[model samples]
Target: MDASSDRELPSTQEDLEIRAVSAERLTFFGDAVVAIALTLLALELPVPEGSTNSEMWHSATSHRDSYLAFMISFVVIAAHWRAHHRVFRHVTATNSRLTSFTMYWLLTLVITPFATDVIGGHGAFQFRFVFYAVVQSAACLLFLLMVREIPRDGLARPGTAPEIFSRSIHRAGMVALGFLISIPVSLVTRWAYVCWIVVPLVDSVIDARKGRTARQSSQD
Candidate 1:
């Protein structure tokens, strides 16, 4: 009895399997949600209607705003999914917080199509534009939270380098900042769209410089 009382138990193989399964399920679910959001965006696309070639071209041109909104949303969702794929690959465990954050992130993704429709609609230009920007920014910020949570909560696989997620966090933050800055700019003029285009270029340059600096520091 005394010997039995002194024995300690180790984690069972089944427990480890469950953890891996949970993480995989979460990732698969996220991917599915993202796919649906993208499909929705396509479904809502404005169909160019006309009786002749010239008419069809004019119709398409008339709905240019709708087409532009669709393009922007499609890119945004694709980028978010790519980043999600990158971070979730390192995740080997799941927790309540991760699940909650992911669900909220997906919510933003789902709302993107609706926001695109609103942005392309007539009237209330600033309000509609800001609404779309806010949605995109929320998606970016939520993803940043997920990236940080993965490593902070020890969800990543053992021996994984912390640096693996550092770049992702930085990218997410920069994208979010771009969207946020555009909000105020939207109030004054439509030139705010330039932020979305310019910020990534700037981030790329910064990232390259940082990489060089890191390399030099390591050499030193």
Candidate 2:
């Protein structure tokens, strides 16, 4: 090849290498963002205002709802990070579209603390519950989109199992469905938070059944 073609080839190859590593860069950035989000969630809990031990205990007891909200949100964010890590583990490359979706997903992740505070401070308000549910559901939806996009964009490494992708999508969808359902349910009753538990509970039963069936099929 000519000198110009040789130079162009190296430049193109360099660009491709950068694109290949983009997913890794994004994953690291995402990990940092999630850590920061969890930290912010903890920071939402206030120090007990009273100076004396008994009085401080009273003040702490008064904010039990805040602590509860913080714990729940922390678990949710940690679950999100785990799911994100699992999906990205198969991803070998990234593009503008994937990056954009990931950024939007992280935006929701970052907003989670604010939503938690809203619900913690105004737990009695139906709208506050709905707002928090909506934020979480949006994050789940965006994550689902990114998971689906992986195979479509050929981002997954060769030989990755189809079942892996399906399960990831299913889990994310179930969580999103739970939150979406909770939104309308919140309007009717203050106990709508219970709806969130349905996702994991149902998912566990379904997973158990699938495991049994797989073992039977293998034996046959």
Candidate 3:
């Protein structure tokens, strides 16, 4: 047989297998990057260097902003990781577009540590607040894009529930909106972080009501 005749066209199943491998690798790399980012955030905490107990106490207290920043960023990173896991769980295959979105999202995750450090070292500055908010908001938006892209890109598994996808995207959008709003709010008041908590609280109440309605409908 001629060389041309001997060549086999790539099968759909083969393509899917390659995509699945790529997606798994991407997720593994994403997990590693997130782990590193969290470590970098923790490292931002200053060592309480002092010879006396009183001096040590003063040093530790002085770094209160760093500690607060570390806690907040840690929680934020953890939330993002959880959301990422949920979204990717439904994804059976990936395309270049989805991969691109994942890369951008990971980029934001990597940048988060620097932003956290800025806020930790200079939390009082409006610029720092806005910068950190922007970084986190970008991460949220990218993840939201990925969540939406999965179904749109035809990467979602056939058995995946549409409601779960919708809820994931909605939650991500809400979180991103909160961060975006906090940017402008930060300019006006130093209490802008309150905006972040407000959105989630409102979402929780709405989700609870939805759950109740669903239960009542099932009972009926």
Candidate 4:
């Protein structure tokens, strides 16, 4: 009989309680999107439409550099996404400024495949290298922005483990610097990807140590 009852419940506290829904969903979608993008690169991998092993090998060899670059890009994106995931894990809410920053990061993430395609053989343009550098730098800046957002939202207070996360972020910033450096380095080395390899390996060491420490700390 009450008009309030007839009006139906407005958006409930449950919805308000989950203020970080957009941030969570963005990270989730980013995980899937980067995954799909990486998988799609495999399709770009040269597969001879022929049956002869010689032809397949030859065709594949012609694409060997491209394939290698694709793999490198995959590693870079995976590392970036890994760092991004943990950064967002402590986030509890999102605002328009942070949302805009994510949009730019996503834009760079989405463009990686196109950059991979361009990175074919040893003949890719320096501009492509520049584009790659700039995109990665942008992602690094966004990563820093996300860290700053934590306190504003009263989410993850600055602490030891969070300091570990901060250290990981600092390493990512180094990778971004490496990416930028590779452009000029490519001016000398045919295998610029050789330098990029350091990113994943470094990320692995950092992540593995973190995982082990986390597991041990939990057990204790």
Order candidates by TM-score, high to low. 1, 2, 3, 4
| Error in Å for residue 98 of model 2 | 0.7
For candidate 2, give the lDDT.
0.90
TM-score of 1: 0.92
Model 1 bad stretches (over 4 Å): 1-11, 216-220
Each candidate's TM vs. the true structure? 0.92, 0.91, 0.91, 0.73
lDDT of 3 by residue, 95-127 (tens): 888889889999898888888888877536799
Candidate 2 deviant stretches above 4 angstroms: 1-13
Query: Model 3 Cα RMSD, Å?
Result: 3.0
In the range 128-194, model 2's lDDT, one tens digit per residue, is 8988999999999999999999999888888999888889899999999989998888899888888
Tell me the whole-model lDDT of each prediction, alpha carbons only: 0.91, 0.90, 0.87, 0.70
Off by over 4 Å in 3: 1-10
- Model 1 residue 103 CA deviation (Å) reads 0.2
Cα displacement (Å) at residue 154, model 4 = 2.8
Give Cα distance to truth, residue 126, candidate 4, Å: 2.9
The window of 10 residues in a row where model 3 has the poorest summed lDDT is 3-12
Local accuracy of candidate 4 as per-residue lDDT tens digits, 148-208: 6666555553352657456665776677666766778777765665555576567768889
Query: C-alpha displacement of 83 in model 2, angstroms?
Result: 0.2
